[model samples]
Target chain A: MDFGAMVDYLPLFEQAMWLTLRIGWIGILGSLVIGLVVAMITHYKIPVLYQISLFYIELYRNTPLLIQLFFMYFALPRVLGVGIDAEACGMLGLALLGGAYMAESFRSGLEAVEPIQTESALSLGMTKAQVMRYVVLPQAVSLSVQSFVANIIFLLKETSVFSAISLMDLMFVAKDLIGLYYNTTECLVLLVIFYLIIILPVSILGTVVERKLRYGAFGS
Target chain B: MELLGLDVLFKGSNAMRLLQGLGVAVEISIISVVISLVLGMLFGIFMTWKNPVARVISRIYLEIVRIMPQLVLLFIVFFGATRALGLNVSAELSSIIVFSFWGVGEMGDLVRGSLESIPVHQYESAAALGMTKGQIYYHVVIPQAVRRLIPMSINLVTRMIKTTSLILMIGVVEVMKVGQQIIEANRMVSPNAVFGIYGTILLLYFLVCWPISMLARHLEKKWSN
Candidate 1:
């Protein structure tokens, strides 16, 4: 409601947005790496590691990201006797939680590649690794693109919880501004706009990519 | 070594407080889920209606819900509304309002999907059999949609329950909040209690959510057949 207050706090929100993007991007990248490894392990059904990956996936997926962050930020240091900063804890927690959901998305995508395609590739004298590299993964990646986008958006939104861990992400800035100025409407309106700015482009791009993928694959 | 820290849970009435916290979380989830189901059913039906305005409105609602984080929505409703709208909404009430708002979007989509999935021929056949529009929907469409709706809605329930953890941020004293309180109180008496207490809370969430997810999977598999 107060335009002047919102304008005055724009700089703070900008800084918070940058922090959010920095941590969210790094966290998403970490999750992508971890997810790929877990997906591969489960896809190949590797001994011992497969079970561990499955447990990791389920344990992370079934719990809230807030708890995971709290445990990592508040509890892990006490147990491990090492100090982890709030930002590191936020990034790590995001990765751990995002990894599980991404793994599920990737695994499903990998599974969606037809068995017949793999069989033919194998019979064509392609090694398993070559078949996976050339034939299966490309198709699987395309199939899972939508879910991957969804997971990315989900994880990014989850960065909101970093405020709870005392990280000055966008949400934290909004809450802090509100606490300081009592401009609840202004702070919250800015919060919503900032989030939309961050999320809308990804969401729009995701739709475009999905349409292209569908058309490219189906000739529709 | 870490097991000793769990002794804090057994000391005094700490465990009871936790169960109470869990109850609050569950209570919030149940209330919102019920509200969402009823409201979402209507929203879903409206979405599927042959009205461009309705479709556009629902689409915008869904997109807004999807784009904004639930935490932000909670803050807006809990903090912003009290100031802007001059409404004296309690934390729990605001939480329910936000959750139900979110659930309606989700559950409405589910309803729309299930309703759309009902074959066109079934509606035609019912019409041919001299059934009124209401009768067609009641006798033919809803029954089939409910079947598909059940498993997905159950999954939504689990999602809602997990998301209720966010309410603790706004000071709802849910399970996570209670766990934090217990850890803070026992920080000195049991420094290691941090790990045990949070780990226990993690386990408690797992216990509450895993079975529900499993059941959703079970129903999905069963109904798919």
Candidate 2:
């Protein structure tokens, strides 16, 4: 249990951390775009799609995310007649699952925007798209910051499950290293610290954004 | 093998798989929730103890639990802790330990909230009634607090069941993992079965979780009334 033993795996763990961040960035960005579109379409109260997306969100939100990851890895390729690599499967699974949650968060933010804001903007000679782009989204994004951040932390954690599918995510590296070395405790301890380093800054940023929203700087 | 349309739901084999998955998911949820509730109550009670030693330990425990992810905690227990301690832990046993320990922290926080949310006079009046401390807790504080606790605890149950899927990462044959194996086995001939099976798995989760969610809502309304 010497503390110095952890330092031996430092370079490999750093490479793993970089991979996790890369996956997180791609997954989070893709989901945000997809979620925002889905959320807005649902928010506008589209005829059939509104009900459909509602059902989708309900199904995704209630299930365990690890289940979703495995489902994607094993299922999607067969259905679509495509050969998806492990990374693609993992990322896509994460986005779909996380997108559903993000849609809910964005919708909460969208709902918080009073109808009056749009009405006033329309009265001020703004087009619907223009009003949404310039006025609604900025505020909604800011307002949803806390839920969004929490969901991201959640997404990061669930990424570990992608290891079950042989994705080269951070936890996979740790698990694989432990298998080779039989240093499960040390490897996992390093993994936890690596996550905390990434996560703590996000938490602090979320709090700051929340405070800004509460004051005059953010939401109206 | 990919199931398209609503016809797959009517298939006997598919339907049975759904039912089986639902059962395991529900069993895991119920066990973890009960374990956590008991542990959480104990931790909550520990929070109120006079000993600074107990209070500090509880505080440290809860903070660590809160900061740590459930998946990481699962890994720590199943992979790291058991190995380090030379313990041969079963997957289900490890899942229970990981979830319940996390639940204690969560439930403790909820308990603290319910306890603090009660007005001070309730406690003072109970004390003034010539009742003992145990009587005050059992008769006065707990019954009222139980109302608020029910809905919150129900939410925790939903979370626990959902989190239980992480057990599959350690090779426990849970619903999702079962679906994965089924899809993989069938993928060569039954191309469509992938989405079909996974979709069924998702719906099974929905069935298990939705009822509890409705119950939580029902409790909240009943208690508020």
Candidate 3:
């Protein structure tokens, strides 16, 4: 295709990449926090909060992130009578959607810790919170590491949709360039390459980490 | 009251348009799922074959599909192909192509995993009984593999359906696009209509996906035992 056009558009794509990474990292962190809290609530089976967390997870997990983004960006502002910008809406929507998936991952991790481990810790006169911290959380974190990496990648790919809400993410920049110059091939090639640049390292690193964890767990 | 914005849905043909939009989304999902299932099964078998070339090619294909965002793939197929290769692919066709490309990778992996999960002794025993390779797969392996395959593929179907929402970007008038059209048309008359319209669209997707996922979970539980 057109190498010249691609080179000319590099700066715009760079700017968009930074915006995407900034929002993606923040959304990833936000989802991790929300996921951890929700997983804890469900794991401990807290009275009302447990049910609420389950509902939240199910609702978010089942619905499309695009619709969630639309509802937050377009609908929420009208209903709440407050203005929310596209970037903020993108970050918020990603966090909420990613949170549900992360919660499920973490919950499965937490459940994977054997009952005997908790029982032995409890019999040792350790407090419930202490047992959770010392006995359960560490193991659970290790177990959930692979899924966490997966969820992170999933969330980052989802940042592509942020364009719909008018965020100038990589996809937005590519579409904008194509609209202006009709360089669809150049723009799309750049889009795919940039996405691979963002995603491939994480995926490779994830596989390495998962293998290491497997060896560490099984002594194989 | 106008505050809730539910009135907009009842007015004129808004509700009908939404249903039609839902139909388009479902239509794409079903077509893509069918194509992926058949092709992915073959790909899955190829993956399990004892050939280095097939192994390396399948690995690269799977990784590429996994690493690239589906939206970028969609843009490439829908926008780039039209200009670069001078192929006139419609939005719906492009969506099906991208989704099936994605689905095949996912389903192929699922098939390979389930196929590999069946123990070696089962194959040996069937061989000892003098069954042909094709018969072995049809009678012994496939029956067991189907158990694991069903629940996971159901999950994939739900994932594919949810992902069809992305087609709206390429200008496919799917459910999300219809919701946007309704809100834009009523923006002045009912500024709050955005809330109801999008919320309804969200509910519609939830309704479509939730039961299928539930069935998947149920099947996994039942079959696992």
Candidate 4:
């Protein structure tokens, strides 16, 4: 274990961590927005589109993001005759996979809300769209906040997989440093701490939000 | 490029690719699941039982498995484990071990949930009936726990199967890995065909997982009765 070289790679690892966070948050938010929209569309059964939303969520959820990422990286070049950069490719992959899980979480939350609330809103002369926008989405989003956060953490951890197709994330940096220095012990130790530094806050934030939600439920 | 065509899956060679992918996926999933279930059950029992040593060990194992990312674990098991062991352990075997450790901790938590969910009254009734501890566990406790356990375990199995695609990172030629090679080799000819190839691969995973997921849901509903 070369403690000294590991020390030198500290800055590289730090930069990688920052990039990972930036790309991951972008992917997470993008997916959440898309997922919520699709979830709403499906939750109301939206006339004849129930199966489409159901199909979309299922298709994305079951596949590994690695293959999805590959599709974005390798497949698009020929079909569209345009190539995307690695960062964009990574975002697309993560969003596709993450969006699926989020839709389910949001849909379940929407379904979990009592039907009477929707009926009351309907009887109050609110249109379906208005009822959904004002009454349903807010409740579902809030109710699903914990699962959403946990899902984000899960996405963040999985971002490492993007390294395979040359996404310059933290794991890539870790792998590069290990290959360069051949100090497996020291490099991996830094990598683990590097992961913890990012993931720990996420874990804490998720728990606190969940606790708050639980407490609020009891108070009400 | 043409790999996305439906005929590719039916053609002998392409069919072989599909079967190979299916074989690796199921093999790794089954191997990991069996090991994980046994490991999980033991840890679950220890966690529920009043044993100090077992309690501490199980907690630590759970935290480590939960916190460590799957990719890093695979990296360690694939590259580092072989180095550490001084043996030529293949990536596939390493994947099984790594997934087993991960799967076991998750399964153990589910088992723990099922065990604790077994009401205290059930135990007391068994005791009143003059059943021994082992008898109570086998006759009264395990049967009820099995219902909850089955659904969650199956769900975990699907999860493990989907995740085994990650093993491709370490050069495991599962479905995803095979798809990558096909796309790369054909990239010059078809361009952007990787999407369709991957899309098909994604569908293949759904095919593998969806029925099991349905079965899990069915079990949950059935057992709830």
**Best-matching candidate per TM-score:** 3
Residues B89-126 of candidate 3 have per-residue lDDT tens digits of 99999999999999999999999999999999999999
**Candidate 1 stretches greater than 4 Å from native:** A215-220, B1-4, B119-140
In model 1 chain B, the worst 10-residue window by lDDT is B1-10
Total clashing residue pairs per candidate? 0, 5, 0, 8
Better of 3 and 4 by TM-score: 3
Model 1 Cα lDDT, one tens digit per residue, B89-116? 9999999999999999999999999999
Interface RMSD for each of the candidates = 1.2, 2.1, 0.8, 2.3
In order, the TM-score of chain B in each prediction is 0.94, 0.88, 0.96, 0.90
Residues A31-122, candidate 1: write the lDDT tens digits.
99999999999998999999999899989988999988888888888767799989888888999898999999889888777788889999
Candidate 3: residue B57 Cα off by (Å) = 1.1
Model 4, A98-216: lDDT tens per residue? Answer: 88989988987787667777899999999989988888766766788887886888898888887878877777887786778677767678888988888878887887877666532
Cα lDDT of model 2 by residue, B18-78, tens digit: 5676677567667878888998987887787879999889878875775677878878888
Off by over 4 Å in 3: B125-135
TM-score of chain B of 3: 0.96
Q: Compare the candidates by lDDT and give the number of the best one.
A: 3
Over A136-159, each residue of candidate 3 has an lDDT whose tens digit, in order, gives 888888888888998998899888
lDDT of 1 at A92: 89
What TM-score does structure 1 among the candidates reach? 0.95
